[model samples]
Target chain A: MDNRPIGVFDSGLGGLTVLKEIIKVLPNENIVYFGDTARVPYGPRSKEAIIKYTFQAINFLMSKNVKAIVIACNTATARSLKEAQSKYNIPIIGVIEAGARTAAYSTKNKIVGVIGTEGTISSKSYNVEIEKLDKDIKIVSKACPLFVPITEEGWANTEVAYLTAKEYLKELLDQGIDSLVLGCTHYPILKRTIGKVVGEEIKLVNPAKETAKDLYDILGKQDILRTVNKDNPIYEYYVSDIPEKFASIGQQFLKRDMDDVKKIEIQKY
Target chain B: MDNRPIGVFDSGLGGLTVLKEIIKVLPNENIVYFGDTARVPYGPRSKEAIIKYTFQAINFLMSKNVKAIVIACNTATARSLKEAQSKYNIPIIGVIEAGARTAAYSTKNKIVGVIGTEGTISSKSYNVEIEKLDKDIKIVSKACPLFVPITEEGWANTEVAYLTAKEYLKELLDQGIDSLVLGCTHYPILKRTIGKVVGEEIKLVNPAKETAKDLYDILGKQDILRTVNKDNPIYEYYVSDIPEKFASIGQQFLKRDMDDVKKIEIQKY
Candidate 1:
């Protein structure tokens, strides 16, 4: 059994939501999370830059001796997941596959909606993965570029958020999608607003929970599950920018107080 | 007369608003612009990272032999203007001084409102500059961090934009501001929405126009104004990410077709 900490890497703090899920699923496993706060919102950036930055984050996590790595950011996953799995020796997991699978299997009408950052949507990673799972499953996707910033601004429940959500989801709703995938890590925070806009009929699939379950299964399959139960599993947080800012928003995302955050020069990786 | 291009730099396409004004003010001058689209929204980044990026952009412009440089981004201007002026030999200008000066001078009731990105507002550049211009002018500032992304999404005139502006301006309007500064470059694009929210009584100060005037004055004072009128003054655009994305949004900002665009490795500079 491997007692090494699992590494969680995101372009920013949105991955805290995924880490929270992981903690719930693997209570005894240690976690080391790195948020690339300096060059965040990988949404509008070039694919080359996203891949480069993703590798750097993975390299940093590898140096920390993580048993496995989870690319928690959708843009990073969509752009660099395949290459990263090939490059790293450890079990490298990305958010897209599990998310796509869940949406593909759950949709009764064979129509699914996916919303994410520009990079993730344009990559068509969700469409690709879902199509592989079921060729007949029709996928509709749109890039809601403002969602991340709106979430970060803490306006998730405001009128502006509702309006923005309605504007973004209208097209997908018009296409009669049965299931919607919250493809970006940050999108989960705006679930209430999105739900109000899309109504109760459409199932909102959050990849964070499914990803955690996938991580647990993979660890067991690889015979790397932490067998011994610790009184307290250590959780460490590292960010490339202000720790205070990360801690503030992170507490909101994780739904718990976080004081073990530190700043690192991520560029060195 | 200096025939070299005048460099304008921003975190992303937001600077094109400022560049458009510069083109109007100095029709005969050649222009070179660099947008760090790869690592944009400097609003949420650390001060150290902002300064480093600002210097890198400046260095790149210097390498291009620019006669002068304009820090077209409010966040970069607020964070690095003074240090940049000290580091570079060529005349360096930032958007803050002119913006602050305009608001400070135009206010009728001595209460001026400032709205910008989190970085710009938190830096208190406008407040500091306005206070310096006139100590008695009461300044109220709020960070509307979502405006940039909303503007970039091309929803600047939509209901979402109106709601966002109304929410952000509520406090400033309640405080009875006589004049408002569109402190971020992207904010100018949302002028119609913002003006509607704050009403006609409160004059909106677009720093782009004032900044262009400031640049014209500085060039004349420094004996660097372009004297010879070329029928076609060259305008070159460079970005750290996809040039096509920049050109498309840039055309909207500039109100002219942009064909002279190139991609650059900004991290190297």
Candidate 2:
């Protein structure tokens, strides 16, 4: 069984949501997370720039000798997942495929809604993946570009955030989809508010949880589950920007003190 | 008189607001602007990272043989202005000082309100600058971090934007301030909504316009104003990420076509 840490990276602290789920599922496994806070909000960037930044983040994770890599950022998954798989020999997992598969299996009406960054919606990666699994599945996707910034600004519970969610999700709800995928990693933090707005009938598919399940299954199949002591598994966090701010906001997702988060220059990778 | 173009740069298209004011004040001078769209939103990054990025942007503008540099970003000005001025040989002007000077001069009640990103507020640069000019002035600052994303998402005119602006501005209004500074470059796009919330009783200071005026005075004193072009001065734009998005959003600021914008890599600098 492999004992190496699983590498997780996103444009910012949103990846901590995925990391939290992964830790819950595999308590014994070590984790190395990198948040590219210095160059975050990859949603509005071009495909070429996303690819370049994602590659650098991946390379930095690889330097830490991770056994597998998890692309926690939806924009990176939509734009550069295939390139990542081809570039690295280690097992690579992205949220888009896992989320799409779960939505395909869980939806009863073959209708789904996806909300993500501009790049993710514009790429139509989830649409293509869901369609590949079931040809009849209809997907409605909207670019909720403000969600990431809202979460970063710590306005998740504020009335302004609720109002913004209503404005951004009104069209998606009007489509009458049975299931909605929280396509971007930062979206789960707003799950309670979004769920309330979208109503209880609409199933909110948290891709971070599904991705953790997918990773658990993959590790099980490969017989690579760590046999180390669960209580003492080491966890490391790295960011390319302000460590203090990361430590502060990251506590919401990690549910623990981030006193040890270290800042590193990822561009050198 | 020196005939070289004046260089202006931001983390993204927000700097176009400053560029627009510069054009209005100095119609005969050529202008060159760079927007680091790929790595925009320097507001949340570390001070060191912001300084590094600003230095790189300055180096890029210097490569273009710019006569002077205008840091059109408030966060950058708050975090990196001193470092930038010390590092670069050319005269560098940031929006913070220009804004603080204007706010100091405009406030009659000595209660001046400032709105910007979290990093800008946390730095306390504007407060320090204003207090230095006149210690009796009371500074009330609020961090409106969502304004950038709201503007970026094209929600500047919707009812949702007005609601968001009201929520963010409520506390500042309660302080009974006579003058307010749009501290972030992106805030200018939301000026109407902000003004509506603050009402006509409070004077809103546009730092970009003040900075442009300062630039005019500096150019006049130095005898570096371009005198060759009276009718048709050239303006060029460059971005580190999406050229198309920059061009489109830039149109809102410059009130002209973005045909002259070119995408270029600035990471090397």
Candidate 3:
């Protein structure tokens, strides 16, 4: 079994949600997470810049000798995953394919709705992945750009969240999608509100969960699973900018106190 | 009179509102507007980074031979204005001082409310400027971080805007502010909804208008006012990245079609 830590990185603290899932699925794995807080909200950035940033993140995690890398951000995944997989030696996983696979398998009516940042929705990666699996699956995708900010504001259970979800999901609901994917990493926190608006009939696919499962499956197959430690797993956190807010808002997202967060100059990579 | 264009730059498209006002104030002057669309929303960035970005923008504008510069963004003004002015020879003015001056002039009750991004509010630039003019005046500052995204989404007139303004302005209204400064450039676009919430008694101090007035005064005093052209004065736009959405949303912010838009690599500056 591999003793090396797994690497996870996102544009910002939204990636913490994915880390939470990894902790649940692989309790013994030491994980190193990097948040690119300095140049975050990778949604509006150009594909070249996103690719550059993703490589920077991966390289930084590699410097720490990670066994595997998980691109926790959907925008980064949709934009940079294929190129990254080809370039990197280690098994690199992105949230898009795993979520798409889960949604495709879970859907009973052959209809799926996807909601994410402008960058992720524009890339149509989910559509491409789903289409690869099942050509007949009808895809209804909506770009909910404001959802990230609203979720970060800690308004997940508030009227703001409800109204926003209602407004964004109305069109998708009308299309009679049987399953919907929470495409953005920040989305799972708002699942209750989204689920309430979409109702219980529609299955909600959280990408973080599927992504963790995918990582676990890969690690097991490759014989890179970490031995279970008697003590707590050591999770090192690195950020491209200040980490105080990361600790505060991130703790809310992860529902755990952040430990050993340090700032790194990402551009140096 | 100088025939050169006036340089106006913001961290993003919010500066276009200032450009729109400058057009109204100095119809004869040519204008060069740069939106650092690639590394935008400078509110959460460090002071050194903000100053570097401002200088990068200034250097780019100077290369185009702008006679003067307007720091149209509140956060940039708060963090980089003095440092930029000291380094550059041109007459550079920031929106904060002018907005404070206007708020000082307009407020009868000596209580003013200021709304802007977290960076702007945290810097207390408006409070410092206003206090310099009138020490006795009470300042109620609130950071409405979500407003910019909402404004960019074209939800300025919707129920969402109304509710957001209502929620944000409640404390300021309770503090009995006679005038409110729209401290962020994006805030002016939501003035109607903000006005409706704050009511008829409170005067809305729009920094863009005051900044335009400040620029006009500087140009006139420096004897560098642009001469009237036979045709319309040319306006050039530059961004660090793609200008597709810039043409559309920027037009909405500028209230006119944009012309001569170009993409530049800002880091080179």
Candidate 4:
């Protein structure tokens, strides 16, 4: 049984959704979570910048002696996950593969809808992965760029959010998609609003749950799962910017007190 | 006459709105504009990070042999403008000063409203500046963080934007503000929507226009104004990330074609 923490990193606070699931699946495992808040929303950045930022995140997590890493952000996963896996020895899992797999299998009409940030849609990572799983599954993709900000603003369930979601999802609904993938980590937080827009007919697949399941399977299969202990497990939070704002917004995603978040200079990594 | 270019930089495409005014005011002058697209949205970041980024932007602009520099982003200006001015030899101007001056003088009821990003509002630069100009003027400020993303998503004039404006401006409207300062660069792009929400009774002060006037006065007083020449004047655009995205969004902000945008590694500066 290994005790080294599992590291999870995202561009910002959105990854806490994935971290919440990770904590549930691997309750006794130590965890190190990093949020690059200073330079976030990697959605509109160039591929080179995303890859560079992803490597920096990996380097920071490696310094914490993590056994494995999870790229909780779809933009980072789509743009840099392969490069990160090739460069590091630790088992690194990204959200795109599990999300694609879930969407490919869940769709009854064989037409799946993928909505995420501009970078994720442009990378076509979900399309590639979903197509590999089933050649017949058609994909309809759209970039809902405003959803992240809307969620972060705590307007996830507001009329503004509903309208934005309805506008973004109308095209996908028109395409007759049976399943919709919440491709970006932040998208899950707006699930209720999104559900109202799509109604009960469309199935929503949140990648965080699938990613956590994948991590759990990998740790168990590799014989690296932490031994269950009654003692309180360590859970550390680090951010590039000040922790006050991160901790405040983080409470929304985590649904728990974020009291001991530390600040780190991510670029130095 | 000094023929050197005027350098204007913002966190992203938002600054193109300011650049538009700079061009109109100083049509004969060469211009070099930089947008830190890779690390845009300095609003939620720490003060230290904003200062570091502002310095990097300044260094990049200085390298281009600019005669003067404008801190076109409100977050950067509020958090780092003074520090930047002290560190650099070149004349540097920020949006806060002109915005505060305009709001303080324009308000007949002595109650002015200021709206910007979280960083700008928290910095309280506008309040401090306006207070210095007229202690009697009551300043009401709010940080509308989602407006940037809404504008960048090209939904500035949409129903989503209208609802968002109504929600954000309701507090200021209740406070009985006679004039409002569009403290953030991106807010000017949503002027029509914002104006519609606030109505004709409330005067809107776009800092970009006042900032251009301030620059014009400074150049004239210092005897550094560029002489008019029928020859083609240079206007270069630089960003930290890829140019394609910046160019596309920039056209909306600029209201003209963005044909020549170059990418630079801003961190190196």
Candidate 5:
């Protein structure tokens, strides 16, 4: 089994949701997470800019000799995943496919709902992926562009957040979807409010969790699982900006003190 | 008169608010705006990073032979305005002093409220500037981080926006501020809701307008005001990321269709 750390990167701290699940499932494996905090909310960026930034993040992660790469950003996955896979020899996975698969499997009446950033929803990547698995599945997609900013502002439980969620999710709920996918990484933080709005009857699938499960199965099959000491696996976190804020917000996702997260200027790379 | 274009720049379209005011005050003068949309929301970035970026933006504007430059962003002004003024020979102005001056002049009870991004509020630049002008003036500052994203999402008038305005302004209102400075350039677009919540008794100072007035006065003093406009004064806009989205949101700030904004890779600069 490989002992090399698995690399995970996102536009910002939202990727910590994916990292949390990865650590929970693969307790012994080392993780190297890069959150592009300086140039976050990649949601509204053009495809060319997203691809260019994603490449920089990937190249940085590769420099660390990661065994596999996980693109924890939905915008990057939708816009640049294939190009990244073609450029790198190491195993590269994106949250979109894992999320699409989970939603496809969980839907009872072939109806699925997806909420993400404007760019992600506009690309219709999730719809195409889900339809590839089951053409009959009806996809209801909404662009909740403000969710990323709301999560970044640490407004997950505030009354304002609940009201914002209600406004963004109202149309999707009216569509009567049985299962919903938190298409953007930032979305998992708002799971409670979103679930309350969508109600208990609708299944809420967190793409981060599904992506973590996919990582587990893939690493298992590839014989790349780190078989090291279980008690204290090293967890390293890197961000493009404000390490102090990242450390605080990261604790919410990791459910542990973030003493190890460091800030690095990724633009210089 | 020098007859050179005035340069204005921000991390994104927020700077357009300043540009719009400048155009209104000096219609005959040419204008150039640069938006670092690719690496926007400089609010969360380090002081050093903000300085570096502000320098680059200034240099770019200087390259256009601009008569003067305006740091149209609150975070940039808070972190890098002094360095920028010292580094460049051209007369440079920032929103902080203009906004602080207006707040000091407009406040009846000598209690001035300010709202902006986390970095802007944390820096307490407005408080410092206002206090420097009048120590007797009491200052109340809150970080309304969600406003930037809400403004970006074109949710200025939605019910969610009204609720967000109410939640963010409640504490500031409780302080019994007589005047509030739209500390961030993006805040002007939310003036209606912010005014509604704080009530008409509280004077809302548009910093961009005050900054524009300051700019006009500075240029007039320097003999740089354009005397002749043989043709329609053209406006050129440049953004580092998605041109389409920037153009759309920029329209709201400039109050005109932005058919001329071009996307450029500013990281290389």
Candidate 6:
């Protein structure tokens, strides 16, 4: 057992979904979550830039003596996870692998649909991972660019979300996919809207849920699970910009209060 | 006469609206447009971060020997215009002044509505500018955070856009605004839909139009309008990240072919 905190970072508030799951599953574990609010939506950025930003995030979290790092953002993970794992000594887990594995295990018809940002969909990381699991599996990928904004605006269950989801998932649904992977960190929040659009025929896989379990398994195996006896576990959130806006939007993703948040210059890391 | 190009920069592609207006009004002026694609949404960032990023954009433009600079993004202008004007040697113009003046002039009733990103609205720059023109003028400002994404997705006229616009503009419309300021650079793209929601009675003041005219007046007063007589006037476009996606999505904003776009590391500037 270890007392060092676990580090988790995402492009922005979307990662709070992952952090929320992490807190729920690992109740005693202290988390150092960083949201790169200054330069978010890593979806449209270059792979090199994403890797650079991911390293900067890792650098910041490592400063707090985190035992492990989780790349909570699908775009960041798809663009940089392997490279980061090769370079860092501490075990690094990315959402793509766990999410893909879960989809692979959960699917009965061998047809899977992926919905995410332009970067993650275009990266084809989910497709590659699922294909690696089974050569005959069929993959359908579509980019739902407006979903982030819809979720960010807290219209996840609203009519706008349903319309937008229907518009984006029409083709994928028509393709007869049995299981769908929410490939973006923010996608999980829109699961209800997405489920409504796809109906009861398709199963939705949230990477956050699987990623939390992945972290738990890895921590237990490595014997680095937080063993501190402190009555209250503190989670620290660092953002590159204003913390109030982060806290407000973050509440939507977290579904809880983020009482301890700080504004830091991420570039300095 | 100064033959150098006019520098126009925004947090992202929204500035293309301003550049489009500039192109239509002043066809002879060579233009250098920079979109901070990597750090696109300055809307929720801190003032310090916005100022820093704005300077980096300014620094990059200055390197290209631009004669004057236009802060085309509302968030950037709201956060850093005054500081930028004081610090930079070249003439700098921001959208807020021209937008406010136009709204002030266009409104039959003193009640005006301003819609923009969170940073632009929260800064109270539009209200302050309009109030400076007439102390008794009533201003209703709303932060339409999802507008940028709708415009970015090129869904300006779609049903989702209509619904989103209806949702955001409901409060402003109920407040009985006679004239509305398109406070953010991107808001002009959603003009038709906005007009549809607000009806033909409420006049929409586009900052891009007024900003272009303001540029014309400033260039004439300074006697620095481009006098170069090349066969084809060059409009160099620079962005902080991948140029391919910018060229594609930018066509929606620019409504023209962008054959000369280059990727630059904005952090270096």
Global lDDT of each model? 0.89, 0.86, 0.90, 0.90, 0.86, 0.88
Give the per-residue Cα lDDT of candidate 5 at A192.
93
Question: Model 2, range A1-269, lDDT digits (tens) per residue?
Answer: 68788999998888999999999998899899999987877776668888899899989998999988899988888888899889888888999898999999989988899998777787898999999999999898888877876787677887777888998889887888999999888889999889879889989999999999999988888888897685678889898887345777899877777768888988899
Using lDDT as the measure, name the better of candidate 1 and candidate 4.
4
Ranking by DockQ: 1, 4, 2, 6, 3, 5
What DockQ does model 2 achieve? 0.39
The positional error of residue A141 in candidate 4, measured at the CA in angstroms, is 2.1
lDDT at position A264, candidate 4? 96
The lDDT, on a scale of 0 to 1, for candidate 4 is 0.90
Error of 5 at A198 (Å): 3.0
**Once model 3 is optimally superposed onto the true structure by TM-score, how far is the C-alpha of residue B248 displaced, in angstroms?**
3.0
Per-residue lDDT tens digits for candidate 5, residues B7-107, read 99998889898888998999998888999987776866678988999988887888889999999998899889999988889999999898899999989
Off by over 4 Å in 3: A1-4, A44-65, A82-89, A226-229, A259-269, B1-3, B44-56, B59-65, B108-111, B134-138, B174-176, B226-231, B259-269
What does DockQ give for each predicted structure? 0.52, 0.39, 0.38, 0.49, 0.36, 0.38
Candidate 1 residue pairs that clash: none
Report each candidate's C-alpha RMSD, comma-separated, in the order given: 3.6, 4.4, 3.1, 3.7, 4.3, 3.7
What TM-score should be assigned to candidate 3?
0.88
Scanning candidate 2 chain A in windows of ten residues, the lowest lDDT window is: A240-249
* Cand. 4 TM to true fold: 0.85
Among the numbered candidates, top TM-score falls to 3
Per-residue error for A132 in candidate 6, Å, reads 3.1
Q: Is candidate 3 or candidate 4 better by DockQ?
A: 4
TM-score of each: 0.86, 0.81, 0.88, 0.85, 0.81, 0.85
lDDT of 3 by residue, A1-269 (tens): 68899999999999999999999999999999999998887877778989999999999999999999999998888889998999999999998889999999999999999998877887899999999999999999998877887877787887877887898899999999999999999999999999899989999999899999999999999999987686667889999987335787998998888866899999999
For model 1, how does the per-residue alpha-carbon lDDT over A1-269 read when each residue is reduced to its tens digit?
68899999998899999998899999999889999987877776667888899899999998888999999988888888988999889999999999999998899999999998877787899999999999999899998878887887788899888988998899999999999999989889999999999999999999999999999999999999997895578898988887335677888899888887888998899
Candidate 1: stretches off by over 4 Å: A1-5, A27-30, A43-67, A79-90, A223-235, A243-245, A264-269, B1-5, B27-30, B42-67, B79-90, B108-110, B135-138, B222-236, B243-245, B259-269
